[model samples]
Target: MTMAAMAVLPSRFIKCFSLSSASAPVSTLQEIASASPQGVAKVVLKKGKTQLFKYGSPMVYSGAVDRIIGRPPPKTGEVVLVADGAEVPIGWGLYNSVSMFCVRLMQLEEEASREPTCALNMERLLEHRINAATDLRRQLGLPSINTNAYRLVNSEGDRLSGLIVDVFGDVAVVASSAAWVEKYKQEIEAFINKVDGISHINWRPSVDILKEEGLDLLQLKHASVASPSQVEVKENGIRYAISLEGQKTGFYADQRENRQFISTIAKGKRVLDVCCYSGGFSLNAAHGGAVSVTGVDSSMPALELAEKNIVLNGLDSERITFLKQDASDFMKKAAARNETWDIVVLDPPKLAPRKEVLQNASGMYRNLNALAMRLTKKGGVLMTCSCSGAMTQSGTFMRVIQGAAAMAGRKVTILRQAGAASDHPIDPSYPEGAYLSNIMLRVL
Candidate 1:
């Protein structure tokens, strides 16, 4: 499909746009022309006998008729077809003149749009998504364990693109990276209020993506209410005190099942949780009866939270050590000190968000995994992961880890391959939704 054809609009609106062809039933090329005072005629579209000027003259669509007859095409602003006859604006979206996907639909139907402004519908969708996620968790029998933390809404996975809500205990951190969601701030806040068992709501907008979308770099418009700053949440019988204002919904819900898997094999072994934000894996290891657990992270605040979680779980604090240092640097330092761990987890943040940086990100992953392998004792477990959607193919991640192991002079045996927790379902058509890849390997 051409970029213009892929533009965001409800199927209903797009269905109304008919393409004509000379040899075909009707001419599809309505018109093509450059829109400038001195520019030549480029392209044009025809509706009945009226010839709608397109390329040469500016594209204009009447708000009253919902028809693209004559007017300058929108360059940067959003496209809104007036409700005329059978045509209606489906939802709000962004439009770009340069790219083929000139229109990016933000919502399906304006009336069905679940923004913060539409409290009733927003709450309904939130409840629907939460109930759906909860049903999957129950069907999986995860409730038999003591864990309560899980993903509530996984962006496009829930058909709510650019919105992520992770529930930790009674608190929910709503992260909106797209302007469409941000635009409905009030509706979101109101919906969050109606949810049962949720007392606090914190909003975190992915500013980086917003900037790329040509949006203003600003703080979260919705201020957080007075909620518990920290609370103990259980995961697979492992306790963790999550901070409401912490990164990516406090704990990494994507790796919940993977952490449990690592714990099952952590009995009586020294485990290192590198880049252990809030000590998800470290606590799991200790709960699984690991001999020792050392959690390393550069964020002091996160380390502090991890410490609280360790105490909350009634685990031996002496057995769990928190280190404030860069994960890669800590691994190198541990190697220098001859410190070895029977199991090591290298769950780093996304190194590459775009495909252009795949090579550089792969190199970084290779270097980190190499260090992780070096820190692992012979025949030890190495649980490494890549949450970058850009590294979509499993082969790409496997090759990088294999290369890293070879550099560390260790042959690796794949024990188990994992992915995002069940709540974060992957659509068959959208492979990008399945971004998290967890591989548990035994270094030989």
Candidate 2:
């Protein structure tokens, strides 16, 4: 079922679970015997909590759960029916005992009734959701001649929480964070294999996250042995060498549109790309006829790949160069030397992985932006980004930038505010799925 109608299901069935809520009480177990599936567990939500799930919030946190109904309680990764306070089945999802997210709802009651083939079926549901994601990408013209590297499944954005799939050429890199995904690894791989242009399935499990999901770290295996360590791919007509062993899903396909945007305004400009992993923006600036481009990152491997990309596209190496240095150190020194760039791009790693570190991360972001602002020429553009979900979802990134501008003693006017590319869709209900905040500001 499509994600738009994913949570539109209304409960009309009688109460089935043994538990009862004060708002809607159940008379007898026989009242809804026909609707309840035999031998299946039910996760009943607290009163007033059903609306959020009904409105398409995929994650059913443990705090929202009233009580669980089952003979033997459902284990983590097991499919369980999610019911309202009245015990009426609203949908079904994978249950996680250890994680804060008690349930990851897959299909709503209406969706289950419409597509009975995948109703209450994890394997079939996976196939249906993956197909839906593929169709969405096809409609968006992904994996086109100019761009073969892109996101296939964007976790909750694609209605499959704790799962992400990125396609780089013939390989489908699946990153698993949920116990259900890990449990159905083979099934997931099989479905991915059926997709076009997917010859290999690379499994990349978020080990630490899986641990929180109650998965055994010792038993987990990462990166398919059959999958190549490195694969070259084309994005926006530029070639890139992606390292499978490297960062999240090998490459940052989310910044596809943002990087392409950098190319458009880079003509004859001196562009500086900080945390320039694999030189996405730097190469784009060079390709866009920039007079000079400098990419700085702490990772040597990334800089090496960036250097190779310049050669891969047969671009003028003399015009584009990469340096391995801490971003803040490089920017501070450049500012001290009175160095300035016509365009400065800052795409940092996740500084605030959790909400607890958001305040500290805000300071880091402010300082980084301040330094980058100091290095920007008057009336120049600065494209800064934060992949921290806490920062983006909290709606404080703009304020942080404003504070940074004040600290830099530079006035800034907003040019454009963007997020992940078109292929990386966001489900409005799950704002957490919306990470990557790319903002364009003119420094004066």
Candidate 3:
């Protein structure tokens, strides 16, 4: 990152890289910018921040940045090298001046020991991380053996924060959250196409993430290719019809294993899948031999797909039903009618988008869980989940559910706990990456 290091670099290689290989016609300015580190800047971090980076952390907040080591700091989405106290290279990251989490680190030299494929160039770094991540999934027997729909790239979890790629059968949905990733969209798309079995690619913008990072879309122009709007995917032998316009990256692939777990225990029982987006769990419950299954969701489009999923699986019509209604209203009504279910699932949308909403989100969790507890039959199972990572402080989510159980005059015991499937591995350094939290409880 020092000025002296620039002296040895060749001038001809300094030009921005072409969007495609030598044969294809070169196009797009942003693509070229993201393709090469022609003018990557340098950033110096404060003393304590170096330790986190040393331990393989991928995010450096604005407060952690001490000063610009060079004459000019990089623009939003531009690459930058982070220097330590003694000007040692900590790693390279996407520098976004506007974002609170300013630097989304891409490569760290310290990780070279553990991650042998780590590299310096932006393009090489992405390719290295993508290959490593996919290789890990293959090792875990992910899409190949278990489910075709799975999380391919988990942002920070895969050493690429602010970006998430979910694979649904032959389709891959690229959900970009950070401003830095906007520039590299085309390159990332090209890399994804290289992976086998990925014929179609869809671009689903993570507008909420973009807004949270305070990234100005005008400055960070994005590029992508067109693909299908819907695709059918198989999970543990159950087929689901998913829409590209639906929830996060089209579908919640994180719950792949959890749905299968529910199926193993759903035999001959009445199951209630609350906030069952696209009926993943509902379909699994019915396929698992549930006596009756009811799925509740507010999204008509999702409910329509969920209904389609039932027929796609060839499940009996009388054994499964889909309801387009608010989860809370349905739960309240079910309690009023004294309708009991052997197993009740409460997987609501992210209640706490950020730390600021943690308290309110906890309250929502408590109330909804209380309603779910009241609706469950005695000795039944209650599967509660929260995708809000900021709010799930170790046992905070379970504590909230326990508090709700106390309020509802019910006794609940933790039977099983689970989270994102193996594909979504959590880096010990990045606690925030542990977004999906699911716990099964036996209610009395």
Q: Whose TM-score is greatest here?
A: 2
**Candidate 1's TM-score:** 0.72
Worst 10 residues of 1 by lDDT: 26-35
Give the runs in model 3 whose Cα sits over 4 Å from its true position: 1-40, 111-118, 211-215, 218-224
Off by over 4 Å in 2: 1-38, 222-224
Best by lDDT: 2
Candidate lDDT (C-alpha), each: 0.68, 0.91, 0.82
Across residues 142-260, which tens digit of lDDT does each residue of candidate 1 receive? Answer: 44457678776777676566678887877778888665567666766676566556777877788877665556665444564676867777788777777766776667888888888
lDDT string, candidate 3, 272-323, tens digits: 9999989989988998999999999999999899888878988988889999
Rank by lDDT, descending?
2, 3, 1
Clashes of 3: 0
Clashes of each: 37, 0, 0
Residue-by-residue lDDT tens digits, candidate 2, 109-178:
8776677777777888899999999999999998899999999999999999999999999999989999
Instruction: Give candidate 2's TM-score.
Output: 0.92
Predictions ranked by TM-score, top down? 2, 3, 1
